[model samples]
Target: MRWFRKKSASTTKTIFGEYCATSSVHGVRYFSDPERTLCEKFWWIVMFLVSVGGCVKLIESTWLKWNLTPIVVNFENQPISVTEIPFPSFTICPPGKISKLMYNFAKEAKQIRNSGAHANAYGSEDCFSTEFE
Candidate 1:
């Protein structure tokens, strides 16, 4: 049984190796080739290093641009007030805010599955009643 598992794992690896050798990506086939010569292998390594260096340079330039650029926020010369902003679209209600007896998870999940529509997991009306506010 152990030998059979090992054989299957080796077969999977062989399939992956075949894919890498046949892939259209440059330098991959050479790198994956089992019979590649020393010179070919050296060239592949050099190509891989150059590709990695180019990627690093690209990321460095992007990082420098992001850091060097100034982000200016204008408040129109007026005091900023939190109340001026609209209320959040949704609020998470704590367990104490909603009665566990009234909320049935299974029933709500079944309703959503049957209807194939999204329903709020928690009842907004019960949780946001005027009394709670």
Candidate 2:
């Protein structure tokens, strides 16, 4: 009886040579290649920078739109009286006063939305929509 069988050429090349060779399968080679890995990392960094820049530009534009069109309120029309209160407590205004405050805010918002510069900056007339009507 033969105790150990002879190694076959086909099995030897397929198992040992392919597995232990410097180059691997196509998928593994693509990922393991240093140049390809560096390229991928470079693209990832570029995409990150682009996204951050886009966000910054959006925030800056919005700020500029708001700053350019100031909200000028007539304090005489809706007077706000401040009342001092005790420590650890707060003073509450009447319901009418709160309603007036909300109405004033809505009016100013409508004016800003109707302004040509602000409307054009936002690219839409209903950008700052409020249900305070």
Measured against the true structure, the TM-scores of the candidates, in listed sequence, are 0.38, 0.29
RMSD (Å) per prediction? 16.5, 21.9
Q: Where in model 1 is the C-alpha error above 4 Å?
A: 1-9, 70-133
Give the Cα error of residue 18 in candidate 1, in Å.
1.7
**C-alpha-based local distance difference test score of model 1:** 0.71
Q: Model 2, residue 52: what's the lDDT? A: 82
RMSD of 2: 21.9
Cα lDDT tens digits for candidate 1, 1-133: 9999999999988987898788897787786687999789789979988999999999999999877864444467875554465555987888788886686576665555455454354544243222210
TM-score of 2: 0.29
| lDDT of candidates 1 onward, in order | 0.71, 0.60
